[model samples]
Target: MTFQGSGPLDTSGVSAGGGGGGGRIAMGGGLGLVVTVVALLFGVNPGDIMGGSGSTGSQQVSADQSELQERIDSCTTIEQANSDDVCRLIATKNSLNDVWPTLMNGYTDPDMKIFSGSINTGCGAASSAMGPFYCPSDETAYFDPSFFQELTRMGGSDGPLAQEYVVAHEFGHHVENLTGVLAKGQRMGNDGSVRIELQADCLAGVWAQHADDGPDAMLAPLTDDQIASVIQTAKAIGDDTIQGSGSNPEGWTHGSARQRQRWFTTGYESGDPSRCDTFATDDL
Candidate 1:
């Protein structure tokens, strides 16, 4: 799953930030916490966790524009994305920009912010522990590349497709926002939350389906191994898998590992957005 050499990438929408010091918020109990423990447990909407407020006392960390440009410049060719992690993210973003318009009407690209440590977002201040998330209020996606390492630490594969799946999944949330499906997710209970997360997973698969379709496709066709790697990553991030021995399906917000893989496969096999309606199905 590598980008083609000819496709051009515009990383102007992305910025890089430096590390800053702050009291890291633990994942456990706190009513004042922006993202609730339930949201963190499920890995669902991050903006929902932030409670629609910007960081109050958190220190503001500015991105070094010159250094950010240097990183972008280094990824001048798609081939560079194949070798470098940051470049791969940039390349994937470009590809998503190209493919999404064809799938949905009135699609506007989301801004991407690459930060170190913690950063303030439209949702609120977020640490790398929150993983990659999309803030619908500002319509931006935030990522700490180090989260890729965290994914591997959590028993997920760190292969290229595995990484791309993460990026694509966040962008899928952007798609849900654009389609007005995200609002449905804001409703009460884990049922809505699980639907939202699983649909995003399906949407990620939809993107992967067409990622290498035509001559202009940025990536080469995915290999079987790459596909397997993505499935493994999806399983690793499942609520049950993450909760381990204390796994509780009744409290699950993101569905089980089998459900995640099945929905992703459905979108991949069908290559149709209509098939991704997790909310309509009785059996998710």
Candidate 2:
């Protein structure tokens, strides 16, 4: 699950922000809770446990591009990425940008914004509590690295692949946007929401399959343990698993642990994006 060499990663597409100052306040909640609310409020979503959002009008925030560039400079090798989470993220983004064009036609690379506290996005203003999400309005993915720590508190793994799974999942949303899937409208109930979320998981698996495919592959061949770690992380974040109650498919937005794990496995095993059409499957 590690990258092969110490090569410079192209991080120009990423921007760093110091965080946002004001907005309408959305109650802070755990990862599961935030995701549920965001899914209900905004059709395009992802989940996380953290801070709250504000209600004020959108205020443009600037990113510290110099700081981000410094970090990118330090990550000239895969070894650096293996050691630093931020570097790993940049490397993963590089790999994603490199591989995605081959997977689909007309693929345009999306920008990633790393922020703290809260920030305004094209979708709206969001707080760190929102977790990592892709905004179709801006075609950008947003992340607050601190959420990874919260993820561990929620019984998720801290392994590298586990983290990559998250990045890949959000990026999967960007892919969904490009494919016109995000425009399909978010429906209530697990059946519709689960399909969207699970498809993202499958897309993450698709990324994993090609992450180590070519001579210029960013990562080394994935090991069984690494894949297992990702599965464990997926299970830990399952709506049912996080709820700690008996399965309730009716209220589920992200699917049960088993479903998440199964769909990810499907994409990983098939190594085909076409196989990840969760909407077509009645069994999901």
Candidate 3:
């Protein structure tokens, strides 16, 4: 990856908070973007990965956790951007803000929240255990840098683009919000639920398509291998793959890994929203 984003592009108005009134820490890298569809339908246990809740408000943290806050606020230099995974997360955030709405056609912009140990959201106060998630109530995406570490624990790749794919995927959920598809799909849980998640994966692929659209595209033109990397990630987190193996098939919500990769590739190769219609197809 050729580092792009440096400092906070729009941190001025962005409010910050800690679990224990320790102020807001940047907690950049460990976070991964997840969506509610994965939780409510997939049986993946959003509580296990999304962390905190919508009701916990913005006050949650420990004294020691507060100390971690200091490190998060620093200027993310290019050196750190290359050397630190957290910094790459920041890049992904910057990149998504740059790419998302352009693809969305018409939608409101949403803020990205990066937390370390734990944080609060419209969903509730969540610990890092729940993984990265987007809370519709706050209209903000929440992430804990340590989530990638958890992904590694699950035997997933920790590559930079791979991680960015996660962020892009969550931003895809925000797209769902603007499109009103999220609320509608939620109503169609189980069968329709998996399609929603796959659509988001397709949207994430759309982001990757233009990740480097600017004068200085951080990552190289997404190679076939890179595309495959993200596809592999989609597969690894699929409902069927997780369920069939260890994640309980009955609880399947996000679709099988095969479905995930298929949808993502559909978007990446075509880069057309029309092609991302998981709803029209019976595959999902």
Top candidate on TM-score is 1
RMSD of each: 3.7, 4.4, 6.8
lDDT tens digits, residue span 1-284, model 2: 48787677777888776445343334442335445543332125432222334433333333343455466567666677787877888888888888789999988999988776567677666766556778778888877777788778877888988888888888888888899876663644446667888999999999999999978788999999999988998888887786666556677777788999999999999889999998887898
lDDT of 3: 0.62
Task: Give the candidate number with the greatest lDDT.
Answer: 1
Q: How many backbone clashes does candidate 3 have?
A: 37
RMSD of 2: 4.4
Report, for all candidates in order, the number of backbone clashes. Answer: 2, 10, 37
lDDT of 2 at 179: 90
Question: Which ranges of candidate 1 are over 4 A from the true structure?
Answer: 18-44, 50-69
TM-score of 2: 0.85
**Predictions in order: lDDT:** 0.77, 0.74, 0.62
User: lDDT tens digits, residues 54-104, model 1?
Assistant: 332333344343455568677777888887888888888998888899998
Displacement of residue 148 (Cα, Å) in model 2 is 1.3
> Per-residue lDDT of 1-284 in model 3, one digit per residue for the tens?
54554434333213333462222222322322333322432222132234332332333344434544454455346445556655665666766776766666776667766666556566555555456667677777766677777666555667777788887777778887777777777777566667778888888777777776666665556667767667767766766554444455444557777778877877777776667777788766
Error of 1 at 172 (Å): 0.4
